[model samples]
Target: MSPKKATEAPLTRYRQTFSGKGSFGEYLDVSRRFGKDKEWGVRINTELLNGNTAINSNDMEAQGIFANIDHRDKKSNTNLLVGYRHLNIEGGARWFSLKAAAIGKEITKVPSAPEASKNYGFDGLAKESEGYIIALNHEQKMNADWKWFLNAGMNSNKLQRNIIGASSNFVIINDKGDVSNNLMSTQTVTKNYYAQLGINGNIKTGAVNHDVTLALDKAWHSIEGAKNMYNNGSMGSVSGNIYSGLQGNNVWYPSIETGLSSKDQYWGISLADTVKYKKAQLLLGVHKHNASVDSYNKITGRVTQTVGSDALCPTYGFVYQPDEHTSLYASHSENFDKGTIVASKYANAGEVLNPAKTKQNEIGFKYANAGFLTSLGIFNIKQANNIDVYKGSDMYLQQDGEQEYQGIELSVNGKLADKWNFMGGLMYLDATQNKTQNGTNDGKTVNGAAKWNAVAVLEYNPDEKFSIVGRAMYTGKADIYNEQLQTPSYMTYDLGVNYKTAFNKTPVTLTAMCYNLTDKNYWTAYGNNLILSSPRTLMLSATFDI
Candidate 1:
C-alpha cells in the first residue's frame, strides 16, 4: 500500500474528528472581614469540573480548594498575607501527527474506508495528578524613607499515568490509521520552593529623586519518580481505517521500566533603582543567576548526564512623561535558565544541555485619560534554539541556532460613550529561525507563529440592571510546517449578556454567553500539528451574595 499524498495539496478545511459526551463545572467562594478598622480578612474558594473532552476517547475531572488570610495594621504600617491551595486531576492522553492534512480526510483515499475509524486512541490508559501550593507575603515600614518586604512560596505535585499500550502519533498508512501499541506506566513527583527578600528606600541625589530597591532570592526544585521513562517496543498492533470510527479496546498490556530524572534549583540576587529627574525616569538593575540540572538512566537509576551554569544579567529602561495624558518608554532585559532535556527518541537522549540565555528589547508609548486609553509598542527578542537535527540514521536533539521574534502591538480600551465602552488590540509579528545546520532553514518563519492577530470587544450598559457585550477575534496565516506550508487565516465572534438584580434582598448576578457565534470551521496550529477549532458553545452562570 502506498501512502496518500493528500497533505501535499493545500489544506482547505479541517475536518472535526472529535466528540464529547458532556461537561460540567461549578465553584463557590466565601469571604469575611473582622478587626476594628476592617483591615483583616479571610477568604475561601472551591471549584470542581468534570467532563469528557471533545477529543474522541478522552475524559477529564478536576477539583481545587483555596484559602487566604490577610491583615494590615495602620499603627505599624504593616501588612501580611498567607494562602494555600490544593488541586487534583484525572484524564486520558493523546498526541497529534506532524502532517497538515485535515482530520478524517486521510482515510478517504483508501478502499477500506467504510470499516476504518477516523478516531484513534487508547482504552486502558489513565492519568492522575495532584498538587499543593502555599504562599506568604509580608511588608513593613522601617521609617518614613525606607520599607522592607518578604515573599515566599512552595509547590509540590505528583503524577501517575498508565499507558496500557502505545500508539503511533496518529498517522495515515496505506489509507488506514495504523499504530504500534506497547505497555508503559510511570509515577513522578516534583517539588519547588522559593523565597525573596527586598528593601526599598527613597533618596535624593542632588536635585534628582530616586527610588532604590535591593533584593535577594533563592529557589530549590527537584523531581523523583518510579520508572520515570518506559518503552515496550511493538507489543501488539492496533490498526484501523482513518476515515471511519476506530474504537479502542479495553485490553491491558504488560508494563515496562525506565530511569529517573531531576532538575536542580536556581538562585538570583538583584538591585534596581529608578531615577526621577524632571519628567523623565530611568531604570537600571542587574541580576546574578545560577542553576544546575541532572538526568539519570531509566533502567539503572544512575546519573547519565549533568549540566550547570552561572551568569550575570542586566536590565535597563527609560520613561518620559511629557504630559499627564501621554508617556513614552523603552527597556531591555536578559535572562538565563536550565536547558532542554533530550527525549528518549533522540540520539542524545537523557542528556541535559547547558542553560539557555534570552534577551529582549522594547520601545513603546501610551496615552491615557478618564474615558479612553491606548498604547502602541514594538519589541524584539532573541533566544537560543533547541531543534531536532537529522544525522545519518538517528535524529539528534541539540542546541543549534538562535530564533528571533520581532513584533508591533497596538491596543485601545475604555469608555467610548455614555452607555458604550470598547477594548481591542492588534499585533503584527515576524519570527524566524536563523543559523541552522548548513543554513537549510536559516530564514524560515518559526512554526505556529501567526503574522497578524487582532481582537475587538464592545460593551453597553443601558442601565444598572443589564449589560451586553460583543467581541471579534482574528488570526492571520501561520506556518504549519518547516516553512513548507501554512494554515489559512480565520476569525471568530462572541456575544454575551449580564443581568444584575436583587432576589429577596440578596444581590444576584446572572451571565449568558454564546461563543463562536457563527459556528465557523477553522484550523489551529500547535507547533507543527494542525488541529480543528472548537465548535460553537453556550455557557450560562449565576452568582448570589447574601
Candidate 2:
C-alpha cells in the first residue's frame, strides 16, 4: 500500500472583534499535517467584557486553549484532544430575577433602575472562577464491513461564589417599592468521568442490508459543596433593602454552615440494528441502564442515604422514501436519567433521589431538490421527575408530577438564486404540567415555555467579495408564572455586511452588524424569571487567513 496524499497543509486563521457594548473577543486556529498520515492543530478563544452601565459596574474575562493530534492509517484513526479554560468575574453581572407583579405596563422593559436590581455586596465580595477539561477519542476499522471505536474523557470543575443572593424567600418588593432578598453563599467542586466502547458493522442477508451496533458505557460523577442561607425563615430577612444593598460579607465565614457531598455512578449497554430493503428502513434498539448514588449528611458528618435504580428502555424508527427527493420517518424512544442532588435551600438538602424517566415520539419528512432543502416534524415528549415546590408549601424539591410537551417544527434552507440564500424556521408548542399535589398546577401551561417562535435569515452576495445579510427573530407570548402572568410577543431584526479582500496576498474578511435594528425592547423568560433584552448594539470584526 502507498501512503495517502496529504490533505491538510500548514495554515492559520485569526479573528478579532469588538462591540459597542464594551465587549471584545479574539479567536485563532492553526493546523498542519505531519507526513501523509498525521495532523496537528491548536485553537484559542477568549472574551472580555466591562459591564459598566448606569445600573452597576462589573468586569468579566474568559479564555480557553485547545490542542489536538490526529493519526490515521488504512484501517484505523485516532484523535486526542486536551483543553484548558479560565473565567474571572468581578462586579454585578449576574442575572436578576423579577417578580411577575413588577412586570409593569411596558411588558418589554424591566422596572426602573434601583427597583429592578440592587447591589448585593458585589463590590466587596471576592469573585473568582475557573475550569478545565480533557478528552480522548479513537476509532478502528476491522474490515470492509465492520468497525469499532472508543471514547473517554474527564471533566473537573471547582467553583467558589462570593456573597451570593438566593431567591429562596423570593426577592421581595413592597407596595412602597422597597426591594430586598435573602442572602447566601456557596462553594462547589464537581468531577465527571465517562468511557464508552462500541462496535458497528454492516451485513447483507437475502435482499436486505442490516447495520448493527452494540456498545457499553460507564459514567461517574461526584460533587462536594457548601451553601449557607442568611435568612430568618422569612421573606426579605436580610439586613439591607435594594437601596442600601448588602456589602462586606465573606463567602467562607464561619457563620456559613450547610453543605452537600455526594457521589453517583452509572452503567449502560445498548444494542441497535437498522434493516433496509428497497426504499424502506427500519430500526430497533434497546438500552439497559443502572445507577447508584450516595449522599452525605452535613450535620451527621456521615453517609446518610444510598439509592439505586435500573431500567430497560427501547427505541424504534421507520423511514420510507417514495421518490428521489422526498422521505418520511417516524421514531419513538425512551430514556432514563439519574436524579439531581437536592440544593441547600431544599428540606431534603444533600439527598439524592430516584431516577427520572422520559419518553418521546416524533414524525417527520424531508424534501430536497433544486438546491433547496425543506423539513417538517412533529414531536411529543413526556417526562417524569420535574423538580418543583409543590403547593407552595413543600420545602423539599419534590417530583410530585409530570409534564407533557407537543410541538411542530418546520425549516427550510438553501439557495434562492445564483447569489442569494435563505434560511428560516418556525415552531409551535403546547406544554402542560399535570399530576400535581392537590392539582394546584394541573392543566396549567408550563412556565417559561413559549407557544410560538420563528426566525428567518436572508443573505445576498452581488459579487465574490461583498455580501449583505438580514435576520428577523420572533417569540410569542409565554406564561411567566403558570398563567398568572404572560409576556407579550415580540420581534427583533438584525442587519450585517461583509467585505472580503486581499492584503499582501493574504485573504481577509471584515464584517459589521447592527442588532435590534429598530431598537426594540423585549423580555426573555427563564423558568418564571424575566430578563430584559439587550438594546440596539453594533459589532465589528475582521478575519485574516495568515
Candidate 3:
C-alpha cells in the first residue's frame, strides 16, 4: 500500500477594535483546507463594533459576518470562488435631526456646531441597519500564459431607527436666554440595493504582455419616516416653530412629502501592456468610462432622463534596475470624476456641466541591503474642471480650475538586532490652488491635505513565548474651508504585548493592547467641527487553537 497522506487542520484568528469610549468589540476568523489537492479552501469571519458617546444614553452596536469558498488547480490554471456576507447596525439617540438647519438650531454658532453631536440630538441619536451581499467569481487559463476572469455580485441594505425614552430634559435658549421646554420623538427608515458584473483577461507574447478589464454596476435606494410628540398628544402635530419658514403645530407632522429614485448604468474598459527587456520595463494603459443616470420623482414617481459625459484616461510607467539591490520607477496617470444627477436636477435653467479631471505623476527609488529595505518617492498632482460648494450658499459651482500638490515620502524597515525590528515612514506635502472663482490665482490651500505625516513602529521578541510591539502616527496642520479655519494635527500612539503557551497540549495566547495612549484631541475630518477622534483605550483578549 501507498504511504498515508498528511492532513491539514483548520486555522482560526481573532482581533479587536480599541476605542477610547468604554465601547469594545472583537472578530473571529477561520480558514480550512479542503480535499487532498490542498488547492481548495474555505474561510469565515465575524466582526462586531460597539460604543457610546457622552451625548447619548444608549450604546451603538454593529455586527458583520462573511464566508467564502475558493478552489484552484495545482498548476494555477483555473480558479473559482463563491461568497456571502451580512452586516447589522443598531443604535439609539436622545434626538435626531434630519436636516442641516435643524442642526443649526441646537448649536449657538453655525460654524462651531459639533458635527457628531448634531447627528442625533444636542447629545442623542439612534440608528440601525442591515445589509446582505452575495458574489460569484471564476477564472480560467486559456493558454500557457493567458488567463480570463469574471465576477458578479449583488447587495441589499435596510436601515431603521428606534426612539423609546429620554434620559434628560433640556431647553433650547436663544441669545436672550428665552427657554422653551419642547420634547419630541421620531423614527425613520431607508433601503438600498446594488448589483455588478465584471470581466478581465491577460495575455503574454515574447517580451510584451497585455491585460484588460471591463465592469458594469447598478443600484437603487429609498427612505421613509414618521414622528410622535409628547406635549402635543397628537401623532402628526407640529410641536413649535424653531425656524421661521413653515406653518405647523407640532414638529412631528409630515413635512417633506417627497420620494426620490434613480437608475444608473456604467461601463468601463481598460487595456494595459508591458514590454520587458534587459534591466528595464515599460508599461502603458488607456481607459474609457461611460455612465448615465435617470432619476424618478418621489411625489410624481416619474423617471427623468440625464446623460453623463464619457471620460478618457491614459497612464504610463517605467521601471529600471541598475543593480541587484537598487531599483527606480516613475509613473503618470489621469483620473476623472463624473457629474452627479443632483446637478442636473438643481442646476440653473440652462446650465451645463462636465466631469472633473485630475493628472498625477510620481517617481520613486527602492534599495534593499543587509536585511533592510528603504524607499523614497516624489509626486506631483494637478486637478482641473473642479467642483466646489459655493461659500455662504447651499449651491455648487463648477469652474475651469487648477490646483497643484507636490509631496515627498520616505520609508524604511529593517531588523536592528536579534530581538528588535522597526519600520517608519515620513511624508511632506505642499499644495495650493492655481485658479479659483476669483479670476486670479489665489495661493489658498485645499482642506484635509496635511503638510506633514509620519508613522513609526517597533517590535521586540525576546523569546518564542512572549513579544511586544508599539506604533505611533502623527499628522501636521491642515487647512479648513469656510472661515478659513485651521485644524491642528495630532499624534497618536499604540502599544501591545502578547504571551503564548500550551494548555492541555492545546495552543493558547493572550494579548493586551492600548491605543491613543495620549488621548490627544483632534478632528477626524475637515469642514465638520466634530471633535471626534479615537480616545485612549485598552483591550485584553484571549485565543485558543486546537
Candidate 4:
C-alpha cells in the first residue's frame, strides 16, 4: 500500500474470534468501515457466552448467546445508524449462606458480638431472563460551527426466578442478598424506552474561545413481578437452646400472592458552555430533570399513588494553566437522581422515594510532561437522602437521611525509564451520616465506605517480542454497618505476560495472567453472609490475526 493510500481506508471490514475451552466458542462480525468521509454498510455480530470461563461467580452458571445487526451511513459530516440486538440469558442460580460469626468477634466484623452466636443464613435461587433492543441514531452537521445528534432506543425484557431450597432458620436469596424465609419463588419482567437529542459546537470571538452543548432526554420504564410467601414456622428449642427462627415445618407451601408492579417516566435537559482566554478556562453547565412514578394494584385494577419530582443541577469549574507543564483547577458539581423502587428490606418497600440530590466541591493541581503525568485533588461531598413522604394507600412508608464525605486523591502515570512504565493512585475518604430519623444513625460511618485505598501497576516491554506486567491493589478497612460491623483491609497483586510471534505467516499473540498473585483472602461483603475475594488463579489465551 502506498504511504498516502494507507492513510485513506476502506468502508467495509470483517473480523472473527475463535476460542477453545474444552468445547469451542466463537465471535464473528462483518461491517462497513467508518473510515471515509462518505460510507454506508451493514454489519452483523454474534457471540456465545459461558459465564464460568469469564470469571468466578457465586450465583449463576450462565450459558447464553447474543447477536446484533447495524446499518451505518456517513455523508460528509453527517452520520446515521440503525441497529437491533437480542439477548437470552438462562441459568441455574446458586444458593448462599452466612453465619453470625462472620459479623462479630475478634475474627469477625464487630468487636462486641460473641463468636458462634446463633448462625442463620438463606439459600436456593435461580433466574432466567431475555431481552431485545431496537435503536436509531442520527447526527447532522447543521453548520460550520454547530453539530447535532439524536439517539433513541426501545427495550423489552422478561425475567423469572425460582426460589427452591430447604426452609431453614435462614435460606439464601441469591449471592447478593437474603430475604425473610417468608419469601417465595418470584418472577418479574420490565420494559423501557429512552431517547436523547443534543446539539454541540464551538465558536471564537476575539481573544475568547467558547464551546457549548444543549440536550434533551426522555425515558419510560415499567415493571411487574409475581411473588410468593412462605408461612408456618414452628419455633422449637433443643438441648436447652432456643432455636426459634424462620425454620419451617416444610409442610405449609407458600401461596402466590398479589405481585407488585410500578411505572415511571423521566424527562431531562442540559445546557453547558466552556470558555477559554489565554491561560484561563472556565466551564458552566445546568441540568433540569423531572420524573414521575405510579404504583399499580393488579387486584384493584387501578394506579394507586404517584410520586413526582423536578430538580435543577448546576456545575462550574475553572482552570489556570500558567505553562504547558502545570495546571490548577477547581470545580463544583451537583447530582440529582430519581429514587428506585424500595427494596424488600426497607421499612418502606414498594414506595417510590422522592429524588436524591448531591453536591461536590473539588480542587486539584496537575503536572504533565512528555512521558509522565501526576495529579492531586481534594473533594467534599454532601448528599440529601431521597425526600420521602407518605403516599396514600401504599404498602411502604417514608425514610430519609443526610450524609457527607470528604476525601483526597493522588494519581501518577508515566514511563519510569526507557522500557518500563508504571501507574498508581491513592485515596482516603471520610464518610459519615450527618442526620437521620430520630438521630439514631447520626454521625455514624456509612455502610460500604472505605477509609483509604491505593493501587499500582508496572509494565516492562523490551522490543515487543515479549512483555511482562505486575500490578498491586489495596483496599483499606471498611464499615459494613456503622461501627457495628467492620472489615479489615487487604492487598492483592497480579502478574501478566504477553508474547508475539507468527502463525502461518500471520501475526499471533500469546497471553497469560495470574490474578490475586499472593492469594490474599479477605472479606469482600459483610452482608448477612460473608463473601471472600477470589484466590490466586491463572488464565491463558491466544489470539491470531486472520
CA RMSD of all predictions: 9.9, 4.9, 7.9, 7.2
- What are the runs in model 4 whose C-alpha is more than 4 Å off? 1-25, 29-31, 34-38, 41-45, 51-124, 162-184, 227-260, 298-301, 344-347, 385-398, 526-530
The digit string of per-residue lDDT tens for model 3 on 1-546 reads: 111112256777666554434567777778787777777777777777777533233365767777766677833422232233333322322221112232336433322223232222322223445666666666666666555565555555543333222111122234222223333343333444444445456556776555555545444444332322233234222222222211223334322222444555566766677767678888878878776555555446676555476788999999999999999999999976554434311222113345577899999999999989999999999976344453221234455467789999999999988989999999999877776667543677765567899999999999989999999999887664422445567788999999998779778788888877765545543322223454455777767775
Query: How high is the lDDT of residue 301 in model 3?
Result: 61
If scored against the real structure, what TM-score would every candidate get?
Answer: 0.83, 0.86, 0.74, 0.77
RMSD from true fold, candidate 1: 9.9
lDDT of 1 at 285: 93
Residue clash pairs of candidate 1: 116-244, 117-244, 117-245, 117-246, 118-244, 166-182, 258-298, 259-298
Winning model by lDDT:
2
lDDT of 1 by residue, 122-203 (tens): 5545666778777777788898889898888888877655443332133333334453333445556778898999999999
Q: Give the worst 10-residue stretch by lDDT in candidate 2.
A: 231-240
Ranking by TM-score: 2, 1, 4, 3
Best by TM-score: 2
Q: Where does candidate 4 have its weakest 10-residue lDDT segment?
A: 1-10
Model 3 residue 267 CA deviation in Å = 1.4
Q: Which of the predicted structures, 1 or 4, would earn the higher lDDT when compared with the native? A: 1
What are the per-model numbers of colliding residue pairs? Answer: 8, 0, 14, 8
Tally clashes: model 3.
14
Please give me the total number of clashing residue pairs in predicted model 2.
0
